[model samples]
Structure formats: structure tokens, C-alpha cells
Target: MADSYMDFTSPNTQFTYTLSDNPFFQKDAQNVINTLSINQLNTLGNVSLLDIFLSKDNVVEPHIHQNATELVYCITGGAVVSLINPYTKELLNFTIAPGQVANVPQGWWHYEVANQDNTHLLAIFDAPVPEVIFGSDILRLTPANVLAHSYCLDEAKVKDTLAPITDTVIIGPPASCSKQHPNGMPMQQMMNHGGMNMAQMAPGSYQQAIQNQTYHYPYRPISGESESYNAPLDHPFHPIPFLYRRWD
Candidate 1:
């Protein structure tokens, strides 16, 4: 009988990994991700993973995976997974605890936030190499005039806000940020200035909010079309389009 482990001619076909062997990104010594992809595991063909570790209120910055879908499983602590569905153009959010999971479709913009200390989540992808576009790059690289004209934003403010993002920040709220939140406000306040009142809500209420909250916006065209043909006049797209809550 031939020994099952005796094939060594191709020394590069690795079958195991120490995920922490490489650091994907880290911020303020509080949040970090150890990414494993085709670059690290030559034998990997259809899948990869990110070992995410985040402290309380820490966030994995908004990003898009152009090549694959992501399945996130929580191993410890709690977190909120948020994504924007481009098709429906609504922002969706989910809160997950240990033993729960969330899925983000390919090419959708998404982010994750840790709700408790020592949060650990595994982000699995369907492609061997999941190509990513971080929001930091988009905010920093685009010409200010283009953004100002398209979004009707102030060019100077756009440039000033994004000037500090010189590097790709996978974990965000850079350590140098000085906009302090007085008192113990909910972490969502840090994400948006008009914070949701989550500090006094029960966990169940929070989950309900995740399940029911939907962002509604008026439809506007980007091209020469008058209105979207398949959409209704009042609310053209689906209201609650993209979020999937796996468990409680």
C-alpha cells in the first residue's frame, strides 16, 4: 500500500495554516484581522477566511469583496453587521451573538462592529482570493471635485475630511481621532453623528430594531433614463432588501 502522506514532490501544496502568522490589519491595538487567502495557502482554491478580533465598540471598516460572498460566524462576544444592498439601495444591519452568523453578498458594501470585548468572528469567503475595496481608499483617492459635483457636497469639506486617510484602514476610528464622545453614549454615535438611542434599549429591543429598521430614500437617476422601469412610483425598490438574520 502506498503511504498517503508520502507525496512531497510538490512542496508548496500546504494543507494547514496558523491564521495569526500574518496580520491583515490592526488599529489602536484594539481591533485586528488575520486574513488567509490564496496568497498564503497555495492549496486553497475556492475558499478563504479572516480571523477577526475586536475589542468593545471597535469596527471592521466598510469594504466590498468583488469576487466572492462572505459568511461571517461569531465565535465569541457580540457584534453588529451592517451592509448596503446596492440593488435596493437600503442600509441593512444585524446584531449577532456567539453561535450566530451573517452573510454578505458579493460586491455589496459592508462593515462589522464589535459590541463586547474580546469579540471573535470568522469571515469565510467563497473565492480563493477575495479582492477587497476598502472605503478608506474610495474616500481618499477620488477627486474632490467629482465627489462634490456628483453628491452635491462641499469640495473643501470632502478634501479636509478624507485627507487623514493616507493608508488602507481595515479597522477604523484611527487612534489619532480626537472627536471624543462625552458620557457613555452608545457606540453607534461614533459611527454616525445623529446616533440612535441604543443605550437604554434591551437586547431584545435591539434585535427587533435590527429586524425591522429600514432606510428609505427617494429614487434618483444616474444616467439618461427618466425613472427605473421595473420600479413603482412611490417606492421603487424593496424597502427591507438585503439583511439576513441567522439567529438570535
Candidate 2:
């Protein structure tokens, strides 16, 4: 059956959208995400996407898409898409380079980490609007006393540990974070010494490290000029119309 809700003859019917103009979250010039949903394009049917750009060691952060299943496609550079399998109770990691892809089941906990500079990923969803529950929100919003009581831990320590997380961290560690590697080792150097397996640690280890506020992943410094670009948001919805030129 055709889409009965959509008015095909209406002048307001939109068929094209520029994802670059819409910024969903921007950690920095190197780390940013733009989103597109049915709201942007009225004719869309249960489809949405996020245009993600990241530098080395930058993470998309652990999150659950309760409303959609995600298919992550790598466009440039490389990334590690990690997800937790609720059935097997295993943390699975998939390293994808250009032309590779990873699929995350709906409601599964997952995250993506850029393994190289200029990593570009497109996260396509099966929902019109992907709803997310960020791990940072879970950690920060939950009552500290309740968490301490449930886990049999110190309440003050729990509160103190989570104090720094004042808002939803879509991408982390946040730009305000000042934590650095004690040994001053570059991420590439560390990976070379021990391989990428070192970064694929268990979730508990990550949680403990976060609680201690010492889990800062080292990134190789960008040599020469940085090619980071942030699209201006002042006029995101107003895209210039493209005119097709006839070949002579």
C-alpha cells in the first residue's frame, strides 16, 4: 500500500536533506555527529541515520538504541564497533575499515571507537527517530545511595566518583576532561606494544576505571595541520538548491 499519510502533491513535501548541516553532537572539530530523521524529511518511513566523524581514540560512547537496530558503515579510515551480547553475555568487538560494516541489534549496549584519524562512519537505523539511553546518563542520573546500597559500596565514594558527569556525554571523554596518560604514551605506541586487544577490555574494568576517573584513552597527536571541520548551525535548515547542468 502507498503511504496514505503523505501528501505527494503538497509543496512542503521534502525529498532531500543535507545531513552535514544538522549537528546532533559535537565534542570538538575532530569529533562530531549529524543526524537525519523523518522529522527532517517528511516522506521517510522508519529510517534515520547519523553522519559520524571522529579522530583517533575518540569514542561514540556506550549507548542503547531502544527503538532501532543500527547498521554502522565505515566510509574512511577505521573503527572498532563493540557491543554486548545479552544472550551469550559476551562483549563482541568488530574492527571495520573502509567498505566494512557492523550491525547492532536493537536495545543492545554498544559503542564505536575511531582507530585512525579522519574516521568517518554512517549509522543507519531502522526507526524514524532513534531513541538512545547513554551510559553516562545511567551512571550520573541513578541515585548514588541506591547504587551504593545495591552494590554494597560506599555512598560518598559513588557520589564523588560520578560528580564530574554533569550532563549526558554522547561522546567521551568530554571536552572538559583533563585526564591524561601518566606514562605519556601515544595510543598507537601502546597498541603496537600490546595490540588492539588491550583496548577491548571487559565492561567492569571500564566501569571501575570510570569510577576512579583514570580511564583516559591515549590518542596519537595529529601531525601538521588538523583537517577538522564543523558545519555552521546558524542556518542548518536552509540548504542551497542544486541545479543540474546539461553536458554539451
Candidate 3:
């Protein structure tokens, strides 16, 4: 258990907090993230969570939570969580539906893509506050000359390609982005042109590829079972045992 130096005997101690009041990132109402941490609820130990809502083809940009491991639980609809294993340098993808979860080890580069509309995921972390390093920030902040020299690419092209990324993109492609694909081809059309390996494609293309149903995921479901499961929207939130039970 995480030690807390709070004065529990004090009347100022807070026992309840509304997570929605604390917004982490909002990419419009449909694609928004609400956060909860020890800062918001002083009684909390070493735990935090992000309530994520995403629409179809929406992505939670690739990032790393350096301080804690994240367990993404699917509450409604479905999504694909992809992570790159540092040890093996392999990209692993997991398709999670309602009642399922995908875990990302601490410091691992990973991202999530909503496969269906009204997808809701709860990202729980083992730390009081989750610190992240987003891919967009790295790409945008890195000097174009440095990247070009390191990758043996054209400096001008690198600058042009990354110029549009003005800020941290938590959910993307940014709302202002007009082009969905690089070559002016729709994502589905590109996938239909020729089946390709998702691992070989750039990180930005993963969401579109997965949405088009072209990328093959590693895990396979039981033959008799359905490929995907959708939770009813009438009851959006599930009951959490810890919330109702007294720890004492």
C-alpha cells in the first residue's frame, strides 16, 4: 500500500471526488479524457485513472507512461491496443472488447484506436499520477536537421511533414486536419489495394489500417465465440466493488 501523510482526523479530509470535473484532454465531446489522481482525491494511494471516450477511427496517440504500468479496460464498444516491446522490438496488438483489458508495461510505447463508435476505456495506472511522453511532442520538438541526419532523410521534407503538429495531439488526427491519408486515398481503399503488414507501416497509419480490418491481430478468439462484443449504452458505467465497500 502507498503511504499517505494526510491528516485523516481533520474535517478537511475529502472522501469523494467527481472525475468528470477534472479534464485531462478533450478532443471534442466524443473524444475526451477525464483524469483522476491523488491530487484530486487526497485519500487515494498509488493509483490513478483516465476515463477515455473515443469515436470510431479515433486514436489515443502513441505515448509512454514512464511512471506506471497502464491497464486499459474496455467498458463499451471495442478498440485495438498496440504496443512495442522494447526487448524484442516487436509490435504487439491486442483487440479488446467490453469486459476485456489490455495491459501496457511501464515505459512501453503504446496507443489505442477505437474500432467502434461510443468506445469507452478506463486506463488505470499504478502511480498516483501518470506522466506521459507523447509521440507528437517528440516528433515536433526534435530538430528536423537532427532527424534527417540520423535517418538519412531530407531535412526539408522532415520539416514540412512535421510542421502541422503545433501541439500535443492526445486524440488524432487533429480536428483541423483535412487529409486523412497521405496519398489522398481513403484508408479502406488503401487497405483493399493490397494487404499489408501493420508492423511495417508507420505509427500514424496503424489506426486507419486497424479500422479497415486489414491488420491481423495476434490473439485469436475461441472458434465458437463471437469476434466482438458491444455493451449496451443504457447502463454506461459498471459497478466497482471497491467504490461500494468500506476498506476498514
- After TM-score superposition, what is the CA distance of residue 125 in candidate 2 from its true location, in Å? 0.4
Cα lDDT computed for each candidate against the true fold: 0.66, 0.69, 0.69
TM-scores, each model vs. reference: 0.70, 0.73, 0.73
Q: What's the distance in Å from true for residue 102, model 3?
A: 0.5
Error of 2 at 13 (Å): 1.2
Against the true structure, candidate 1 has what lDDT? 0.66
Superior candidate under TM-score, 1 versus 3: 3
CA deviation > 4 Å runs, candidate 1: 1-11, 178-184, 189-248
Q: Name the better of 1 and 2 by lDDT.
A: 2
How far does residue 160 in candidate 1 sit from its true spot (Å)?
2.1
TM-score of 1: 0.70
